[model samples]
Target: MDKKLAAEHLLQDVSHYHGPMIRQMKQLVDIYIKLAELETRREDTNRKVALPREIRSVKQLELVPVVTATIPVDRSCQYNEGSFPFFRGLSDSVTVMNGINAPKVVECFGSDGQKYKQLAKSGNDDLRQDAVMEQFFGLVNTFLHNNRDTWKRRLAVRTYKVIPFTPSAGVLEWVDGTIPLGDYLIGSSRSEGAHGRYGIGNWKYPKCREHMSSAKDKRKAFVDVCTNFRPVMHYFFLEKFLQPADWFVKRLAYTRSVAASSMESIFTFDDIYPLSA
Candidate 1:
């Protein structure tokens, strides 16, 4: 064929071969652009949708209420036993409870008062002494309980139910438990142990010994599998168990410290006022 005719024929063949592919590529690009636009629209819609007022209000509510009571220091009062006095002025009571002052040292004329006096005297000024420590710890416990709601709110803590995987089912078949997120996030020994065993150990299997004639061969295969699997299992355990456990523990410790600091900031020695003489 002449050069001009040959070149024309070659160009025709090239277009014939590449025409469908070029058309398909353009269609794919159009589809991708449409998908990108849809995704952007979806994100914008999500951002614009506000939470319902009722749900928002419920979220704002405290997880638990502050529990406080008028614990009487007076043993002589007839109604002191198993009786919690309700003050009319809630604000005044809170002020008294949280006010800063040295703890009141009341002289006990009765037997109970005498015992209180003796206990206090034994502790002297050392809050760490047995009797004083008990009192201090008791107060600390109350303080923590009272402010639990505050800490939960500050941390934006939310509860969720988690089901764990069973050993036989493996991760694919594992179901989450129905426990509250608050409880699960606390990182109990039971949860940690279960996760460690199932996530790391469940995949390990004994060697198939049907083809092996010698016991030594079977044993060697088993040992080899176990040895090779150790690092993989260790990595899974660290990723799924140890790291999460550490994070949970640190958060809990921080919450406790915040609670303690909150208590210290509000309470004073004077708040432990002496009972009426």
Candidate 2:
């Protein structure tokens, strides 16, 4: 009951644009995915109609990008010093990413004759706190790296630039080629139906009961089975790996490493003792 309430409370401030943003992102990705398929088909169609090598290269070079949307007149995007100071303006090719918040992948031009891809996100309760947390984590990672007592690989903490445009909005340096851990665990796209979120429905083994049709019923079922939550969570663990025992062994080692790093980061900082102790 408490957990369900907390989840609702957290999502209370979800922006009205959240749904549109997700739809836009999906639409954009779908367009690109279809375009890629069409390109493959075109290549097959042109297989027999081969041109000269030089002509082929020229044709490829002639494929200039077209701007589909009108550029915004408000070209100026201000950022604090040391955070993309050379950033000049936004490009027309804005990509909405898949998520509840629906972040945008914006192309920014720099004065140094280069382009950068930054993630522009809005509809946050407070992004300033997120920026602060990132900065503090970076500091902790630096401390761990400098200390010889830390792991051999050091704290492989990835830090990127975060510029808060407002209390509830910000631009983050885009990290390419990343997958969500939740997606990794699921091994594919989320399941179908309204209550298809991870660990929400009934597990596969020893089929306890049918999955509730409505979201409210699903939530109620999940909450009622909280006492036997281990089996429910274990279902996901098994889903992630074929061999449960082997997965458990590896998970323990990974958990220990993460826990040690967390402890070291907190205890090493003298400022944390007063608050934590």
Highest-scoring model, lDDT: 2
Candidate 1: pairs in clash: 101-269, 101-270, 102-269, 102-270, 103-269, 160-181, 162-176, 162-177, 163-176, 163-177
TM-score of each: 0.18, 0.44
Off by over 4 Å in 1: 1-130, 146-242, 269-277
lDDT of each: 0.32, 0.48
Candidate 2 off by > 4 Å: 1-85, 112-114, 187-189, 192-261, 264-277
User: lDDT per residue, candidate 1, 33-105, as tens digits?
Assistant: 2221221222232132222232222211111111122144567744532343221111100001001221111
| Poorest 10 consecutive residues by lDDT, candidate 1 | 90-99
* Backbone collision tally, model 1: 10
Question: What is candidate 2's local distance difference test score?
Answer: 0.48
Consecutive 10-residue window with the lowest summed lDDT within model 2 = 59-68
Candidate 2: clashing residue pairs, number: 0
Steric overlap count per candidate:
10, 0
